[model samples]
Structures are given as C-alpha cells and as structure tokens.
Target: MGKATGFMDFKRQKGKEQPPLQRLKDFGEYTSRLEDEELSKQGARCMDCGTPFCHMGIEIRGMAAGCPIQNVIPEWNDLVYKGQWKEALQRLQMTNNFPEFTGRVCPAPCEGSCTLAISDPAVAIKSIERSIIDKGFENGWITARIPKTRSNYRVAVVGSGPAGLAAADQLNQQGHRVTVLERADRAGGLLMYGIPNMKLDKYIVKRRVDLLAEEGITFLLNTEVGKDITHAQLKETYDAIILCVGSTVQRVLHMEGSDAQGVIPAMDYLNGTTQSLLDGVTAPINTKNKHIIVIGGGDTGADCVATALRQGAKSVHQFGKHPALPKKRAADQPWPADPQVYKLDYAYEEAAAKFGSDPREYCIQTTKIVASSNGKLKELHTIQMDKITNDEGYIYFEEVPGTEKVWPVDFVFVAIGFDGVEQSIGEHFGVKVLNNRLYATMKNYETNTAGVFAAGDARRGQSLIVWAIREGREVAAQVHGFLEEKNIKALA
Candidate 1:
C-alpha cells in the first residue's frame, strides 16, 4: 500500500539467525534484529491485497491459515514501510496485545496465507512485527498507561500465561482491579517455563509482566487458586473470576519401562530446566553427556532436541510414528491453506549441526523403553511403521515386519502431547467440564457458574500462544460487558 511497485521492488529476506553451532552454546536469542533500512525493504514486500487472507483468521485444509489474533497486517506493513514505527506499534496493539510473544514463538501462519505467497515468497511479516515491537522497546515508546478512572470491578485471573496475562492487561485497562494468580514460583506460565529461553527470552516475559504490574494489574505468584488459596475465598473477594489454567497435564506413554526413573515428561524436563536457570540452581534433569531420546516429533520434541544440545548432550534422537513429509505442498493443500510441509525447525538445524545428522526419525515407533541394571533408562525397543487410514478414517499405524531395533539411551523424554486441562480446577471451582474434552468455558467464555469464565487452553484446549492471547482479549471484553450489565441491573 505504501508503494504500488513495492512488492515488485523488494525481495523477501528472513531475519537472520545465528549459526546453530555457535547459538547452541548459550540460551540467548539467536535472531539478529534487522536494521531499519532492511526492515523497511521487507515491509515493502507486502502486496496488501483487497481480500488479504493474512489476517482473516480462517481455517484452511483443517489447519489454521492466518493470524489467529487477526492482526492488521497490511496497515502495519504500510506503516513500517513509511517509517512510521510508533504508529506501526500502535496499529499492532489494536488487535494483538502481545506481538512480542507471537513474533518470536508463533509459526507465522499469516505468511503462509499471504497473497504474495501464492507465487512469490511472502512478506517478512513476522520479522517486521518483531522489529516494530523491538524498536518500540528501544525507543521507550512501550510504557505503562494506567487507567484514570476505576469501574469499581474486581476480577481475579487464574494462570499467568498468555491468556491470563492478556485478560488481566485488558481488564485492568478497562478500569477493573485485576489480579493474576500463578501456581508457579513466578508468573508467565508456559511462557516462563514450557518454552525455551533462546526462542523467547525470559527478560521479555518479565518486562511485560513488570509493565502490567505498573499498570495496576496485580500478580500473585506461588499461590494456586484451588490449593494454597480456597476458591470460596476468591468468590468472596473478587466480583468475577476467569480461569486461564492451560492444559498442564502431559500425555504419558504406556509402554514397558515408561516409568523408568530417567524417563520424564517433556514439560517436566523443560519446566525444571527453566526454573533452575531462573533460580540460579542446577537443573533437576540434565542431558549433559547423556544419550537422550525424545519421543514425539512435534514442537515440544524439537525444543527438547535443542535444549539437550545446549545442555551438552552427547547424542539426541527424536522418534515419531508419522512418515517423512512431502517436499512440496500436496494437492489437497491449496493456497491460503496451512499445509503440513516438510521443514527443518531450529532444533533440527542445531541437531544436524552438532550430531552431523537430523535428530528427527520419522515412521519409527518405540514399542518399549528398557531400563538398565542401575535402574535408569538404558535402551529403547523400536520398529518401523506404515500408516493406514481405514474406512472409518481412524489412522492405524501398521508395523513393518521384522523391523524391530534397539538403541542405547540415558534419558527419555515423553513429548507426545498433553492430556487436557488440569482436573483439580474443576473440583476446586465447581465449574462444568465440556464433553469429549476437558475444557470448562461456556458461550462468551462464561463457565456454568455465574461470575466465572474460562479462556486460553483451559477454555479451548491446547492451542498456539497467539490463540491463547486472542481468547484472553475476547474473554476480557465479555467480562467487561458482564460487569457493566450487572451494574445496570443493580441500578434498575
């Protein structure tokens, strides 16, 4: 929109990342922030279509295809191109409350659905976004704006993750006395633990949390809603409550030797490592000089591979049941649709650099984890698999004949998936759980009980942090409306 020929003049250039060999040594951010001139050129690559799908928030081919928060991609793109960074940051904040989080961790679906991506490479939207916010930080444009008036509403947000933080930020801005409760020793939930430090620096998370506190949003750490503090006490204290407790229960493998002392959940390993780093103590679980095996080839598994390398793992291998992906997008995956394409992420890149081979092993299934004489994970029995979708469309992986193999290992991380939201929340709050899933939110994020609502992974199950932020903002609006309606009813 800034220049009619901007898309033609500028070629897509991704933000530069440190070489894996060097970056794996430390937990600092690897991506180098682009200079202003280069970022302006990147922003010029936006086509800014009349029906831009980048921010449409549509589901394509059964997968998310655009910015889940529906960010105004083109407006910010134009602003960045015109060197209006302050205005760009303002426009970005219009929809996304935390562009900084998504800028680093989100798998930019917006670029995948970009109009320019139909043929040419998509605009560097993610890089531009990060640049905008990073510039705002450097220029001191990002600061706390405390509300002048109070709505006289008191709200308690459970979970200090993306959803809880977003809800608390918006509610506090709307003149509500909002308090965020985090069970962890510190706030920021998964952002502070589940994710690795290199990808999302804890300083960034802490900075935002600190700003939120300055804006009058109270954060109470080391106090879980249903545990240390009673639910009845919260009901008596706050006028409204919103649950943002994410899907915390990690899915476990039921194979033999799965309970080996050295075998642990992915979240546990990740969380402990982060907590140890924050506390300036040794990690409870370490992969240094250990042959580590991570099960499940999802983002969590990839993160394990990267983290293990940083921890000085002797060797790392990640196994998955799914087959290797096709090199190009398949026919079913049309334009504007998110396709499950073959791509190497940061961990895989680091793994290949350190181990001289990719850590991800597809179409391989581990049948059992075996313990050694010392009662630690020693080896894993695995086999090759061929997947088949039956008449009912349930995927049944068929084991290849005589393909059993075993590999030596010291530590095993079960990164398969999450079960659902933690159940203790239901017992504590008397909230109704949804059928088929453990989610507990009703329409407009309202729970069955009055004056209570749920958002993020707790309401929608395990999803992207971007989606969590979106749900948090929406839930905040709903909370505001509910409170205003209540006040009107009392006046009447």
Candidate 2:
C-alpha cells in the first residue's frame, strides 16, 4: 500500500466537467483530467482490501459489479499513488488491453464495488486510470511492439470495434497474420460512428488503430464478408475467422404513427451526426429550432438528447418506462454491489441547466405519435405507468388513469436499445442463434460451424465496450490454440 492511512486521509474527488451552458454549444469532450498530484491523491484512497471485490467481477442482484475484465485495480492504484505512472499503465494493461477506451466510457463498476464506498465515497478508480494512460501517451511510452517472427497462419476478424480490435491485437502479438474487415468506410465500427465525438474523440480511436496497423495488423475498411466477399471465400482464404460484428438492429416501440417521417433510430441519428461532423459537412438531421423527444432512459438516449441540444434544438424531452430510482441505495442493495441510485450524467445535467428542470419523464409510455399534413411528427401522446407484481411471480406495469398528455415535438429519436446482430450476417454465415436472437456459442466462443467463432455484441448481444474487449481477447486465444493444433497435426 502506498500510504497506510491514505484511504482515511484523502476524500474521493471526481473529474471536473465543463459548465453545462458552455458544453451544450459544441460536440467536444466536457470532462477535464485531474493534475498529476491530484490524481495521485485520488489513487492513494484505494484501501486495497484483502478480498479485493473491485476485481472480482461478480453478479449481484442480476447486475454486474466490479471490473468485467478482472482488472488489477488495487495493484495499479498503489502504483499510481507512488507516482509510478509508467508502472501503473503497465499493470493496468496486464488485464485490460484498452484502458483508454474503458476509462473514458465505462460506468466504473470498480468504483461502485470499492470497499470505501460502503460508508464514505468511493475511490476515483476510473479517473486514475484515465490519468495513467494519458501520461503514457504524453511521455510517448505507448509504442507498437511488433512481433519478431510470423506464425504464417492467417486469421480474419469481421468487425473493427473494441472486441474485433482486441482480438486482432492479441492474434498479431502471437505472430499470426491478422486482418480486420469493416463494412463501414472507416475502421473502428461503433467507436467511429455510434459514439458521439464528445464522449470519445474519433482521433483517439484513430490513434489506437494506427498503432495496431503499425504492429502489422491489416485493417480492410469498407470490405464486408458475406456481402462484398462471400463467407465461403473468407473461410477458404483464412485459417480462422472471428465475427465481432456488434448488435446493430434497433428495437422499436410498436406504437401508433411509429413510421412517421421524423421518427428515427438513436444509433442512426448519432452515427449520422458524428459522420457529418467528422467529414466537416452539415449534419443531415439537424435539430435546429426543433422540439425533440427521445424515448428511453439509458446512456444512448441521454446521448441523443445531448446531441440534439448541441445541434441547437429549441427544447428536448426524454421518457423512461421505469420509474426514477432513489437517490441512495435501496434496502436490497449493499456494499460491493452497483447500487441502483440516481445520478446526473453530463447530458442530463446539461439539459437541466438549459431547461430549468430535469428533462426526463419517468414511468411514461408513448402511446402514439401525432404527425402534421406533411407526414412529419408534430407531438407525442404519452401516459404514466405504475409497476405492480402479479400472482405468478411476475412483474407488470399498469397505465395510470387520467395521466395522458401530449408534448409538442418536431423530431423523435427511439433509443429503446438493440435487438441483436443484423439477421443478414447471421443468415449468410448459417450460424445458429439462440431464442434471444444472439449467436449460439459453446466453449471458447466457437459457433456450430468449425473454425468459425463469435464475440462481442454479436455473440452476447448489446453490452458495454469492456465486455466486448474481454470477448475479443478470449476468442483470439481460442483461435490461436486451434491454429497451433492444426499446424502440429499437419507437421506430424
């Protein structure tokens, strides 16, 4: 431990964010990094518990707790506390291949499971992690470690998102010839488009992609297997293939007037906006002077609201099917578990500051969308709901009586969530899918088809970037083992 009483002496300090009013004006990163000394103090707050549940990654009450990739949180916390940033970065990378992405985007289950959070505030593990990586980049310590020799075995990774990138990186390190095929014009699938540039800059994504390319991994942008090239052709050309194409099909609200012209999917809106911004062209779906309604209360919905506000929307409103959670942890939730509590994310705070109230409407359901003569959406008709338990041990929602209301809206973004991988890709490859519509996988992420594997959102459905990276790394190990065994058998 860096300091015996460090946890007691230092209180947790969160990363600062730009003023809400100022940040709403553009699509730039709002969160500010802490100074080296301040970050060290935050890291010192880690108690480094005997059990260290921060890295256990257990499921509590059906929700994930701690780091999913089993990150060595305590070890790196101590290294940072001692001002050994280079060492801290190395320890952080031991388990997590991409700390920079997770540090910026992850919900930080490690902090939620921190022993210190039982009573006092939790250690700022996420901020400390970001600091370590930022220092590594500034010092030019992060460089490509190209392999000295080649295994001569070829592997094809379909998708260039976090999972696909991690898989390619691991396979390249193992001396295998790896190539990532992306259907999008640019590499870094979701990272390149789905995510707004404010939360995660596209340049940061490009920086990592460039590093991976330098390490001898080939990235084939705009080349899609099962479409541009047949799946059979890929199977014949490469010894192994890993499918990391994330869940892209958006779930829709089957309500009246859902097919209105102004109604659009959240991913489509965010992707379109980011692409336009990156290309220095005007966004096709401009929200200028429009009253926007975003359906859903998750991160994606919040992102849509933020994006709209930045695009000069006159007003915005968000709806959630579930009721707002309590400000503090509930009775059933305890320490070492991610609490179901209310907190204002950057987007929500910005909305509150601008609208003079929280823009979220909880326990509400949109029954129908009203459109104008031009077939453009004009307003949303919604009703409040209440949660109730049924006799069959099931939960249900009942619409509250006399709570119907109509809100003026010019644009509507459905941020309900994703269904699964696009059906076309799975059908073309003939991979078996579970009842939930996700890839059916067995040991080591291998599908029913031999030498064919799956990972990330495609295999496990829509999930965090951290989970995707873990799946990618695990699948790469499986692919490497399979290739090595084949080589040995052929030699014999």
How displaced is residue 488 in candidate 2, in Å? 1.6
Prediction 1 TM-score vs. true: 0.98
Tens-digit lDDT track for model 1 on 172-210? Answer: 999999999998888899999999999999999999999
lDDT scores of the candidates, listed in order:
0.89, 0.90
Candidate 2 Cα deviation (angstroms), residue 248: 0.9
lDDT tens digits by residue: candidate 2, 382-477: 999998878997989999999999899988999998888888888888899888789898887889888889999999888889888889999999
Best by lDDT: 2
Q: What CA RMSD would you report for each candidate?
A: 1.3, 1.1
The alpha-carbon lDDT assigned to residue 424 of candidate 2 equals 85
TM-scores vs. true structure, each candidate: 0.98, 0.98
| Predicted candidate 1, C-alpha RMSD | 1.3
